[model samples]
Target chain A: MVEHMGAQFLLSMTTGIFIGGAAGYLGSLMLSKRMALVAGPLGHLTLPGIALALLYGFNVSLGAFPFVILGIILIWLFEIRTKLPMEALTAIVFSSGVAVAFLFLPIEQAETALVGDISRVNLWEAFVSVIVTSIVFLVLKKMYSGMVLISISEDLAKSEGMDVRKYNLIYLVLIAIIVALGVKMVGGLLTAALVAIPAAAARNISTKLAHYSFGATIIGAMSSFIGILFAEISKFSAGPLIILTNTGIFLISLVFKNRGRR
Target chain B: MTNDFVLKVKNLTVRIDSQNIIENLSFQVKSGDVITILGPNGAGKTVLFRTLLGLLPHEGEIEWKSGIKLGYVPQRLPFIKDIPLSVNDFFKLKKSSERETKEILDSVGFRENLKKKKIGDLSSGQFQRILIAWALIRNPHVLLFDEPTTGIDISGEETVYSLLARLKQERNLTMLLITHDLSVVYKFSTDVICLNKHLVCYGPPRKVLTMESLRQLFGEEVKFYQHRHG
Candidate 1:
């Protein structure tokens, strides 16, 4: 039994690291663009997709795919139709989305926590997450130049004849997709923490934008892997432990950075 | 004179937050025409530059016919410094030839060694020169500068103006320079526009900058100084 638990821990740790790395990349891109708050909303709103998929007898993650797309469309429409800033729109979507998920909750939800709950993510799930994370990272890397240009000044970008609107919407959708895929291992509540904390910590230390991206990815993987190990030893929830580790790193980085400045 | 005009603004008026910063301001800049836009600190010079670039909300038509692209040197260099952009990366943004970047930097009196250096690490004067080089890399047909010499020291200001003179001579580029530098105005400017939220004077340096006209533009506090050199 001890050996079996150890094997399960190793698999979870490996899966957690790859998914965390992808979250870090997404978060880094958002931070560079000064839009770090979008992560939480995107992550939470992913639940409706998972729930609806389960209701239809589909794979929970697969059901999440279309709902993620729908969420992106809704966000885009809100952006165009409403005067609200992106942050406020995301918050509204997240709260309403979570509330809607509660509506569909069956009495037995207390037992299963939703149909076919992903309490213990297996090797196949982990493998799929790793592949998805790699693809997301590669696509973002290729568009780094255009992304940087947009981040600095939209006016400059427009004068250069870049399609600023398309890039922004596409980027938002990409972020949503990444969050949707990462929902199972880290769960919705803590998934965005993996993205935001590592990137925020990296931002405090990195002088260059590119360096921040690289540093965030490294820090994210380390925290997730270490947190998994700690959870195994302490018999605590892996998700919360991973989040606490990231939060610790963030606070520590902030303290040291401020002191050095003084 | 026909060959000198690089930029032409017609009936230009810019509104910000319901306040009109520039009103019906019109002017022409010929090739190698070093035009100075002089006004008080808050007199809408920067707004006019941004307006002309179609960056800010404005009411006006600005035409640049030199077939020359514009290279902008913004007033605030501090904003650029906060980014971790290397000089090499700045050049890469324009996607210009390496030879062109080297030549432009050389003309601005900046060393090649600084290319790999981050923007924040450069000294004020060094950073200013690099910015000018960034503008020049576009091979601008007309150069639009918004108080390029604002925060620099005397020597740095002199270096920037001298570089402007050199570039103007070499490329016959039309330069629309905005400044509050009274000392160098007569010496460098071929034409000058005196503005106080509206166009008060726009013509040759000697004609538009007369004592009487200066008084009307700057009010009772206006002080006139005869150019010892020009």
Candidate 2:
């Protein structure tokens, strides 16, 4: 444990835990929908926004927000117009975002954008993220069954009175918000892993979706807490450590599943 | 619209990718009609169903009776057997009441014990019944089933057939079923629509399913064993 629980450290930690948990829960839906790799490219789509944030010396999420939203909207539009698969559309935006980001990104500031510095979080940012996380959690919980119903059968979902395209656009926007907040905890390159791995672990042992969904949140929060704490103690890069911690939890979950099966 | 009409499609045309999948297709259905649609692969049966459901934009009129609940069993088999949802969780995606879930499950002959079983672990037969159950729980006035040839219980259709018949008998549901199976039409369909981009024929299956119609809808070598239907 750290000798001192400084206020700055606590604020960053709280925001990290909340974002990690929400991302993990969102990832459960992504995994079930068979779009697990979506978050990775969406992370890459955040680069242009993060670069602008770094250039302007503002909160990184504020800059990342608009760009991620633009990318998601474009992906949605192209998905309808071209009828291309979502992964292909996301890959298209990912490349464009990265290429655009590098046009004016300073070499010295590149590392911070690529590998985030959570300690840069301010009290106001932390508070905003907390509120956003709670609202996302509740709204997602309401939409959870409806969204999963769409994945099960779009026709069925439509018959149930869901507007599939509208729900999908809204779903993408929610994902954008989470991805924007995620950049500060694990940076653009590793944010997908942060979202995906915990959900994967939770699925291993869960029979019901409620278990899988809630379990992912807990595992996600645990990984962020342990990873960030250890990083602070060891002076290591938090992003890589957080991902490694997520992987460890996934492996343990595999073992737990095997044990339960036997 | 007729007083007891369940559905009416007038000059319906659906264009996708700048190509017309369905063109000037028209049909009407009564309250208790079981209309079976048959055609070879690439026929617009599925497209017609989607157009009627208002999922796809169409340049014609499709109408359902006001305040009628619709349940659709999609054509493509759901590859959900590997996902982490229990059967009960799958039902919970729509209905939340324990009593309703149990009632729906039992109506389809689904064992109560299997409620906790992962949907991914159920046999295709069980899953198919579950899909039927999922649709039936809504007490829909009509059911649309897109029946593909494979990925369901290929060894037998007895359970599913009986379950569907029983449910329809009890509820007096209007049905629109799309299938490639001729025996299904012989056994259960009140009316059959033969389609291949245009309406080939539409009437009682006995008169409408002549060999000439089959060859026209399918290809020159088309044949079927109508007597084997049971």
Candidate 3:
């Protein structure tokens, strides 16, 4: 099975596991904070950068970084200055990002930029994805308790002498980096599905935070692997297939959750 | 500046969107004093507490005697039921050990084996008690409560107040409480501060909680009932 598929397919699969697992883990924190709704907009915000990168023949992930970081900063500043809810701030910033992308990107490359073509992934992109994913996972592990405490109550976290603002900024930066890395393989439109669906599925079956996080990672990795395999065999787009796989897992978990209640 | 004063606020002002929520407020909190703040809705009680805790950006001096730890029990725990957190998991935020958690829960008179129970499953009184236990685990030099008994019943309110009074005596802890209930103001407080955006009066409950001040803080429609206790 390994030898039959070409190097590009294998590299894409490897990238998928690392990115998917990391997204799943971070997604659980986002869900707990009631910030999951921002994930979609943040993902879409990467399009302008990817479009500019393709136009200029630079690394798409590298190009996506500046825009995503800017978006995160804008959202953070607006949240603080206006005291607006994060979802609202994200919507405002993301709509502008979409408008910007349409301004620069040609019609021919728009579909590929929107849905992604993982089969075109090269060795270096795969390697960068693995490294970035590892860093994301490690940072999230160290900050897990602090993040959960903040989500529980910012006032409580503040009383404990924890810098809630610093942690919040770090969390947004991590999400931006992950979105940048994922946009190349999953496409800007579908990147949030990688972050959100597995976590939603995991929450259905999990009774503890630790279990929830671990379950999300497993579900994410499984979906990415299976989706990539099926897409290769059927000549279908890998991004939507992966999301569909995650949705299927969520439905199955919901059934189990309802049974447990009984 | 003296050791007897646990906290001193000098001309503290908090302005949000060009509106002054707390303006030119100054007070000194002595060690081992139970100071309760009485105010009507939107009187900036919560904002004052947040300013003192350094949670909000404010203009003025809020000086705590060096190294005095502060604990806070918010008006209510927000969205505890919406999250799937257990009591034990909630305690773990403090990084307390299992033994410490059990001891704190026992101190708050929660005798059930509720460590594994979801926080949302607990009754309002139980949840409020858990918040108290959480604050106690820190062994704070001063504890702050913002409308601690808001959702509790009348009987449960008595229990919570009595428990707080007992804890204060046992631990020799200074307390700052925000409340609208006059009974709580008279019964538990060593000092009362009547506030409506600024300090109306501050002194012993009998001196400061007069009908004239109540009318000024609340409206002319306000009625005062003095409780007689043996």
lDDT of 2 by residue, B75-147 (tens): 6545464458998998888865788899889888877898999887777777778888888886989999888
lDDT of 3 by residue, B1-230 (tens): 56699999999899978899988899889999999998888889999998889888999899998989988998876755535677898898889889999998988888648888778778888888898889888688999988753578777777888999989988899999998778888888889988889998889998877778878888853653333321
Clash pairs (backbone) in predicted model 3: none
Alpha carbon lDDT at B90, candidate 3? 87
Candidate 3 lDDT over residue span A1-262, tens digit each: 5664687788989998888899888888888887776767777888899899889877777878887787777766776778887778767766877788899898798876787767777788889889999999999999988998898889889988999889998999898888887787678788878888888898888766678889988998899898889988998988888889999999999999899789
Local distance difference test, each candidate: 0.72, 0.83, 0.84
lDDT of 2 by residue, A33-99 (tens): 8766777777887888899989988888888888778766676578667888876776787788789
lDDT of 1 by residue, B1-230 (tens): 37545677889988877898899998887666778998876788888877766677767788877455777777764345434567776677667678887887888887787777777667777777776777777677777787753557777877778888888888777788898776667778988888889998888877778777777776654643334332
Highest TM-score, which number?
2
Interface RMSD of each: 3.2, 1.8, 1.7
DockQ for each numbered candidate = 0.26, 0.62, 0.50
In model 1, state the lDDT of residue B1: 39
Q: Which portions of model 1 show Cα errors greater than 4 Å?
A: A1-15, A44-119, A122-128, A207-210, A248-262, B1-5, B13-23, B40-44, B54-61, B77-83, B96-104, B123-125, B148-155, B170-172, B195-198, B211-230
Give DockQ: model 3: 0.50
**Cα lDDT, model 3, residue A137:** 97
Q: Which regions of candidate 3 are displaced past 4 Å?
A: A1-6, A56-58, A82-96, A103-108, A260-262, B1-3, B79-82, B148-150, B224-230
Q: TM-score of chain A for each candidate?
A: 0.86, 0.92, 0.93
